[model samples]
Target: MNTLQRRNAIKDELQNQKLISAKKLALKYGVSRQTIVGDIALLRAQGQPIISTVSGYKYQEAGTAYHGVVVCQHTIEQTREELEAIISLGGEVVDVLIDHSVYGQIVGTLGLANQADINDFMSRVKNVNHNLLASLTNGIHLHNISCSDEKVFNSIQQRLDDLHFLYHD
Candidate 1:
Protein backbone atom coordinates (compact mmCIF):
# COMPACT_ATOMS: atom_id res chain seq x y z
CA MET A 1 0.00 0.00 0.00
CA ASN A 2 2.62 2.51 1.13
CA THR A 3 6.36 2.57 0.45
CA LEU A 4 7.30 0.82 3.67
CA GLN A 5 4.55 -1.75 3.21
CA ARG A 6 5.62 -2.31 -0.38
CA ARG A 7 9.26 -2.74 0.62
CA ASN A 8 8.34 -5.17 3.36
CA ALA A 9 6.14 -7.07 0.92
CA ILE A 10 8.98 -7.23 -1.56
CA LYS A 11 11.26 -8.65 1.11
CA ASP A 12 8.62 -11.17 2.10
CA GLU A 13 8.08 -12.16 -1.50
CA LEU A 14 11.80 -12.78 -2.00
CA GLN A 15 12.02 -14.76 1.23
CA ASN A 16 9.09 -16.96 0.29
CA GLN A 17 10.37 -17.78 -3.17
CA LYS A 18 13.57 -18.63 -5.00
CA LEU A 19 13.81 -15.48 -7.13
CA ILE A 20 11.74 -12.59 -8.47
CA SER A 21 12.51 -9.93 -11.04
CA ALA A 22 12.35 -6.22 -10.25
CA LYS A 23 9.99 -5.68 -13.16
CA LYS A 24 7.59 -8.33 -11.86
CA LEU A 25 7.73 -6.97 -8.33
CA ALA A 26 7.17 -3.44 -9.63
CA LEU A 27 4.09 -4.59 -11.51
CA LYS A 28 2.76 -6.28 -8.39
CA TYR A 29 3.42 -3.25 -6.23
CA GLY A 30 1.95 -0.81 -8.81
CA VAL A 31 5.24 1.11 -8.95
CA SER A 32 7.94 1.79 -11.53
CA ARG A 33 10.76 -0.70 -11.96
CA GLN A 34 13.26 1.90 -10.81
CA THR A 35 11.26 2.28 -7.59
CA ILE A 36 11.57 -1.44 -6.97
CA VAL A 37 15.29 -1.27 -7.75
CA GLY A 38 15.69 1.52 -5.25
CA ASP A 39 13.77 -0.48 -2.66
CA ILE A 40 16.06 -3.45 -3.26
CA ALA A 41 19.11 -1.24 -2.88
CA LEU A 42 17.79 0.20 0.40
CA LEU A 43 16.99 -3.30 1.63
CA ARG A 44 20.51 -4.39 0.73
CA ALA A 45 21.93 -1.37 2.54
CA GLN A 46 19.96 -2.56 5.54
CA GLY A 47 21.79 -5.94 5.24
CA GLN A 48 19.52 -8.28 3.35
CA PRO A 49 21.43 -11.30 2.00
CA ILE A 50 19.90 -10.79 -1.42
CA ILE A 51 21.98 -11.69 -4.48
CA SER A 52 21.10 -10.36 -7.90
CA THR A 53 21.44 -12.91 -10.66
CA VAL A 54 20.55 -12.64 -14.34
CA SER A 55 17.15 -14.25 -13.79
CA GLY A 56 16.32 -12.21 -10.63
CA TYR A 57 17.21 -11.65 -6.99
CA LYS A 58 17.29 -14.45 -4.44
CA TYR A 59 18.08 -14.70 -0.77
CA GLN A 60 21.36 -16.51 -0.18
CA GLU A 61 22.20 -18.53 2.89
CA ALA A 62 25.63 -18.11 4.39
CA GLY A 63 27.24 -21.38 5.28
CA THR A 64 30.67 -22.86 5.96
CA ALA A 65 31.32 -23.50 2.30
CA TYR A 66 34.86 -24.27 1.20
CA HIS A 67 36.25 -21.81 -1.32
CA GLY A 68 39.20 -22.30 -3.65
CA VAL A 69 40.59 -20.58 -6.68
CA VAL A 70 41.16 -22.70 -9.76
CA VAL A 71 43.49 -21.31 -12.39
CA CYS A 72 43.05 -22.62 -15.90
CA GLN A 73 43.72 -21.89 -19.55
CA HIS A 74 41.32 -22.99 -22.22
CA THR A 75 39.86 -22.04 -25.55
CA ILE A 76 36.38 -20.52 -25.79
CA GLU A 77 35.12 -23.82 -27.18
CA GLN A 78 36.02 -25.60 -23.93
CA THR A 79 34.12 -23.22 -21.69
CA ARG A 80 31.29 -25.64 -20.99
CA GLU A 81 33.68 -28.49 -20.20
CA GLU A 82 35.59 -26.39 -17.73
CA LEU A 83 32.47 -25.13 -15.99
CA GLU A 84 30.83 -28.56 -16.03
CA ALA A 85 33.81 -30.27 -14.39
CA ILE A 86 33.69 -27.83 -11.48
CA ILE A 87 29.91 -27.66 -11.12
CA SER A 88 29.54 -31.43 -11.35
CA LEU A 89 31.74 -31.77 -8.30
CA GLY A 90 29.46 -29.51 -6.22
CA GLY A 91 31.44 -26.35 -6.80
CA GLU A 92 29.76 -23.02 -7.44
CA VAL A 93 31.88 -20.88 -9.70
CA VAL A 94 31.45 -17.57 -7.93
CA ASP A 95 33.45 -15.44 -10.32
CA VAL A 96 36.07 -15.38 -13.01
CA LEU A 97 39.19 -13.27 -12.56
CA ILE A 98 41.80 -12.26 -15.11
CA ASP A 99 44.95 -10.24 -14.55
CA HIS A 100 45.98 -7.79 -17.27
CA SER A 101 49.28 -6.06 -17.77
CA VAL A 102 47.94 -2.52 -18.07
CA TYR A 103 44.40 -2.59 -16.63
CA GLY A 104 45.05 -4.90 -13.64
CA GLN A 105 42.41 -7.46 -12.59
CA ILE A 106 39.16 -7.89 -14.49
CA VAL A 107 36.41 -9.97 -12.90
CA GLY A 108 33.11 -11.42 -14.08
CA THR A 109 30.49 -12.59 -11.63
CA LEU A 110 29.27 -15.99 -12.79
CA GLY A 111 27.42 -17.44 -9.77
CA LEU A 112 27.29 -20.65 -11.69
CA ALA A 113 26.23 -23.47 -9.33
CA ASN A 114 24.66 -25.96 -11.65
CA GLN A 115 24.50 -27.16 -15.22
CA ALA A 116 21.42 -25.07 -15.89
CA ASP A 117 23.09 -21.91 -14.62
CA ILE A 118 26.13 -22.68 -16.76
CA ASN A 119 23.90 -23.16 -19.79
CA ASP A 120 22.09 -19.91 -19.21
CA PHE A 121 25.31 -18.01 -18.68
CA MET A 122 26.83 -19.36 -21.90
CA SER A 123 23.66 -18.53 -23.81
CA ARG A 124 23.76 -14.96 -22.56
CA VAL A 125 27.44 -14.75 -23.50
CA LYS A 126 26.54 -15.71 -27.06
CA ASN A 127 23.52 -13.40 -27.24
CA VAL A 128 25.45 -10.41 -25.90
CA ASN A 129 28.52 -10.93 -28.13
CA HIS A 130 30.86 -10.08 -25.28
CA ASN A 131 34.33 -11.55 -25.10
CA LEU A 132 35.22 -13.90 -22.30
CA LEU A 133 37.64 -12.33 -19.84
CA ALA A 134 40.14 -15.10 -20.58
CA SER A 135 40.42 -13.96 -24.19
CA LEU A 136 42.22 -10.84 -23.04
CA THR A 137 44.97 -12.99 -21.53
CA ASN A 138 45.14 -15.70 -24.16
CA GLY A 139 42.92 -18.08 -22.14
CA ILE A 140 44.54 -17.85 -18.74
CA HIS A 141 42.16 -16.95 -15.93
CA LEU A 142 41.13 -17.90 -12.42
CA HIS A 143 37.77 -19.04 -11.19
CA ASN A 144 36.85 -18.65 -7.53
CA ILE A 145 34.84 -21.75 -6.67
CA SER A 146 32.85 -22.52 -3.55
CA CYS A 147 32.07 -26.08 -2.62
CA SER A 148 30.97 -28.13 0.37
CA ASP A 149 34.37 -29.73 1.00
CA GLU A 150 37.98 -30.03 0.02
CA LYS A 151 37.22 -33.33 -1.69
CA VAL A 152 35.05 -31.60 -4.25
CA PHE A 153 37.73 -28.99 -4.81
CA ASN A 154 40.29 -31.69 -5.38
CA SER A 155 38.02 -33.45 -7.80
CA ILE A 156 37.50 -30.22 -9.69
CA GLN A 157 41.26 -29.72 -9.89
CA GLN A 158 41.83 -33.26 -11.06
CA ARG A 159 39.05 -33.00 -13.61
CA LEU A 160 40.41 -29.77 -14.97
CA ASP A 161 43.82 -31.35 -15.16
CA ASP A 162 42.38 -34.28 -17.02
CA LEU A 163 40.77 -31.87 -19.43
CA HIS A 164 44.20 -30.23 -19.86
CA PHE A 165 42.74 -26.91 -18.83
CA LEU A 166 44.71 -26.42 -15.66
CA TYR A 167 47.36 -23.80 -16.13
CA HIS A 168 50.64 -24.58 -14.37
CA ASP A 169 51.12 -20.99 -13.44
Candidate 2:
Protein backbone atom coordinates (compact mmCIF):
# COMPACT_ATOMS: atom_id res chain seq x y z
CA MET A 1 0.00 0.00 0.00
CA ASN A 2 1.00 3.62 -0.45
CA THR A 3 2.07 5.79 2.47
CA LEU A 4 -1.32 7.53 2.63
CA GLN A 5 -3.17 4.21 2.50
CA ARG A 6 -0.97 2.74 5.20
CA ARG A 7 -1.38 5.80 7.41
CA ASN A 8 -5.15 5.82 7.02
CA ALA A 9 -5.32 2.12 7.81
CA ILE A 10 -3.30 2.60 10.96
CA LYS A 11 -5.49 5.47 12.10
CA ASP A 12 -8.67 3.48 11.42
CA GLU A 13 -7.28 0.55 13.41
CA LEU A 14 -6.40 2.85 16.29
CA GLN A 15 -9.88 4.41 16.21
CA ASN A 16 -11.45 0.97 16.49
CA GLN A 17 -9.01 -0.50 19.00
CA LYS A 18 -8.02 2.60 21.05
CA LEU A 19 -4.33 1.63 21.03
CA ILE A 20 -1.62 0.85 18.48
CA SER A 21 2.08 0.25 18.54
CA ALA A 22 4.91 1.22 16.20
CA LYS A 23 6.03 -2.38 15.78
CA LYS A 24 2.53 -3.57 14.92
CA LEU A 25 2.03 -0.83 12.38
CA ALA A 26 5.41 -1.56 10.85
CA LEU A 27 4.61 -5.26 10.48
CA LYS A 28 1.14 -4.67 9.07
CA TYR A 29 2.29 -2.12 6.51
CA GLY A 30 5.55 -3.93 5.69
CA VAL A 31 7.32 -0.62 6.21
CA SER A 32 10.44 0.33 8.11
CA ARG A 33 10.10 1.63 11.64
CA GLN A 34 11.14 5.02 10.31
CA THR A 35 8.31 4.91 7.81
CA ILE A 36 5.84 4.08 10.53
CA VAL A 37 7.11 6.97 12.59
CA GLY A 38 6.77 9.32 9.63
CA ASP A 39 3.24 8.09 9.01
CA ILE A 40 2.30 8.67 12.63
CA ALA A 41 3.83 12.13 12.41
CA LEU A 42 1.75 12.89 9.34
CA LEU A 43 -1.40 11.71 11.07
CA ARG A 44 -0.61 13.87 14.09
CA ALA A 45 0.17 16.88 11.93
CA GLN A 46 -3.26 16.48 10.39
CA GLY A 47 -4.76 17.15 13.84
CA GLN A 48 -5.35 13.65 15.16
CA PRO A 49 -5.31 13.95 18.94
CA ILE A 50 -3.10 10.91 19.33
CA ILE A 51 -1.49 10.58 22.72
CA SER A 52 1.58 8.44 23.21
CA THR A 53 1.42 6.72 26.55
CA VAL A 54 3.64 3.97 27.95
CA SER A 55 1.05 1.48 26.73
CA GLY A 56 0.86 2.84 23.17
CA TYR A 57 -0.85 5.44 21.06
CA LYS A 58 -4.43 6.46 21.90
CA TYR A 59 -6.77 8.62 19.88
CA GLN A 60 -8.97 11.03 21.79
CA GLU A 61 -11.79 11.94 19.45
CA ALA A 62 -13.80 15.05 19.83
CA GLY A 63 -16.80 14.76 22.21
CA THR A 64 -15.46 11.51 23.58
CA ALA A 65 -16.71 10.71 27.05
CA TYR A 66 -14.40 12.13 29.72
CA HIS A 67 -14.17 14.74 32.42
CA GLY A 68 -13.63 18.40 31.60
CA VAL A 69 -11.04 20.90 32.80
CA VAL A 70 -11.78 23.00 35.88
CA VAL A 71 -9.57 26.09 36.02
CA CYS A 72 -8.60 27.06 39.57
CA GLN A 73 -6.15 29.51 41.09
CA HIS A 74 -4.67 29.20 44.58
CA THR A 75 -1.49 29.48 46.55
CA ILE A 76 0.96 26.58 46.29
CA GLU A 77 -0.14 25.30 49.69
CA GLN A 78 -3.75 25.72 48.68
CA THR A 79 -3.03 23.78 45.50
CA ARG A 80 -1.85 20.83 47.52
CA GLU A 81 -4.85 21.08 49.82
CA GLU A 82 -7.28 21.26 46.90
CA LEU A 83 -5.75 18.21 45.26
CA GLU A 84 -6.07 16.23 48.48
CA ALA A 85 -9.68 17.32 48.86
CA ILE A 86 -10.62 16.19 45.34
CA ILE A 87 -9.09 12.77 45.82
CA SER A 88 -10.83 12.50 49.19
CA LEU A 89 -14.11 13.01 47.41
CA GLY A 90 -13.47 9.89 45.30
CA GLY A 91 -12.54 11.83 42.21
CA GLU A 92 -9.36 11.15 40.30
CA VAL A 93 -7.12 14.09 39.57
CA VAL A 94 -6.33 13.32 35.98
CA ASP A 95 -3.89 16.14 35.26
CA VAL A 96 -2.64 19.62 36.11
CA LEU A 97 -3.01 22.03 33.19
CA ILE A 98 -1.33 25.38 32.76
CA ASP A 99 -0.86 27.94 30.05
CA HIS A 100 2.66 29.13 29.37
CA SER A 101 3.49 32.40 27.75
CA VAL A 102 5.77 30.63 25.28
CA TYR A 103 4.66 27.00 25.18
CA GLY A 104 0.88 27.29 25.08
CA GLN A 105 -1.01 24.68 27.13
CA ILE A 106 0.97 22.41 29.44
CA VAL A 107 -0.65 19.41 31.15
CA GLY A 108 0.77 16.72 33.40
CA THR A 109 -1.28 13.71 34.41
CA LEU A 110 -1.34 12.77 38.09
CA GLY A 111 -3.27 9.53 38.50
CA LEU A 112 -3.67 9.57 42.26
CA ALA A 113 -6.68 7.70 43.63
CA ASN A 114 -6.39 8.00 47.43
CA GLN A 115 -4.48 9.44 50.33
CA ALA A 116 -1.63 7.00 50.02
CA ASP A 117 -1.45 7.80 46.36
CA ILE A 118 -1.56 11.48 47.19
CA ASN A 119 1.27 11.11 49.66
CA ASP A 120 3.39 9.29 47.13
CA PHE A 121 2.58 11.96 44.55
CA MET A 122 3.41 14.80 46.92
CA SER A 123 6.58 13.06 47.90
CA ARG A 124 7.64 12.81 44.28
CA VAL A 125 6.73 16.45 43.72
CA LYS A 126 8.72 17.51 46.75
CA ASN A 127 11.66 15.39 45.72
CA VAL A 128 11.56 17.15 42.40
CA ASN A 129 11.26 20.47 44.18
CA HIS A 130 7.73 20.76 42.90
CA ASN A 131 9.15 21.67 39.52
CA LEU A 132 6.72 19.63 37.51
CA LEU A 133 4.81 21.11 34.56
CA ALA A 134 2.12 23.07 36.40
CA SER A 135 4.38 23.83 39.34
CA LEU A 136 6.02 26.52 37.25
CA THR A 137 2.77 28.46 37.26
CA ASN A 138 2.94 29.05 41.03
CA GLY A 139 -0.42 27.47 41.96
CA ILE A 140 -2.50 28.87 39.12
CA HIS A 141 -3.48 25.69 37.35
CA LEU A 142 -6.27 23.70 35.79
CA HIS A 143 -7.32 20.28 36.97
CA ASN A 144 -8.92 17.68 34.76
CA ILE A 145 -10.84 15.62 37.25
CA SER A 146 -12.92 12.52 36.64
CA CYS A 147 -15.75 11.07 38.73
CA SER A 148 -18.28 8.32 38.22
CA ASP A 149 -21.16 10.69 37.62
CA GLU A 150 -22.39 14.27 37.60
CA LYS A 151 -23.39 14.07 41.28
CA VAL A 152 -19.83 13.31 42.23
CA PHE A 153 -18.64 16.07 39.94
CA ASN A 154 -21.01 18.56 41.57
CA SER A 155 -19.94 17.46 45.01
CA ILE A 156 -16.29 17.96 44.15
CA GLN A 157 -16.98 21.33 42.62
CA GLN A 158 -18.89 22.41 45.71
CA ARG A 159 -15.99 21.38 47.91
CA LEU A 160 -13.58 23.34 45.75
CA ASP A 161 -15.82 26.36 45.99
CA ASP A 162 -16.07 25.97 49.76
CA LEU A 163 -12.31 25.96 49.94
CA HIS A 164 -12.17 29.04 47.70
CA PHE A 165 -10.17 27.18 45.11
CA LEU A 166 -12.52 27.39 42.18
CA TYR A 167 -11.82 30.19 39.73
CA HIS A 168 -14.90 32.15 38.76
CA ASP A 169 -14.90 34.48 35.79
> TM-score winner among the candidates?
1
> For candidate 2, what is the TM-score?
0.59
TM-score of each: 0.86, 0.59
Candidate 1: TM-score?
0.86
Tell me the whole-model lDDT of each prediction, alpha carbons only.
0.88, 0.74
> Scored by Cα lDDT, where does model 1 land?
0.88
Give candidate 2's root-mean-square deviation (CA, Å): 5.8
Q: List, residue by residue over 4-55, the lDDT tens digit for candidate 1.
A: 9998999999999977889899899899999999999999999998877766
Query: Where does candidate 1 have its weakest 10-residue lDDT segment?
Result: 55-64
Off by over 4 Å in 1: none
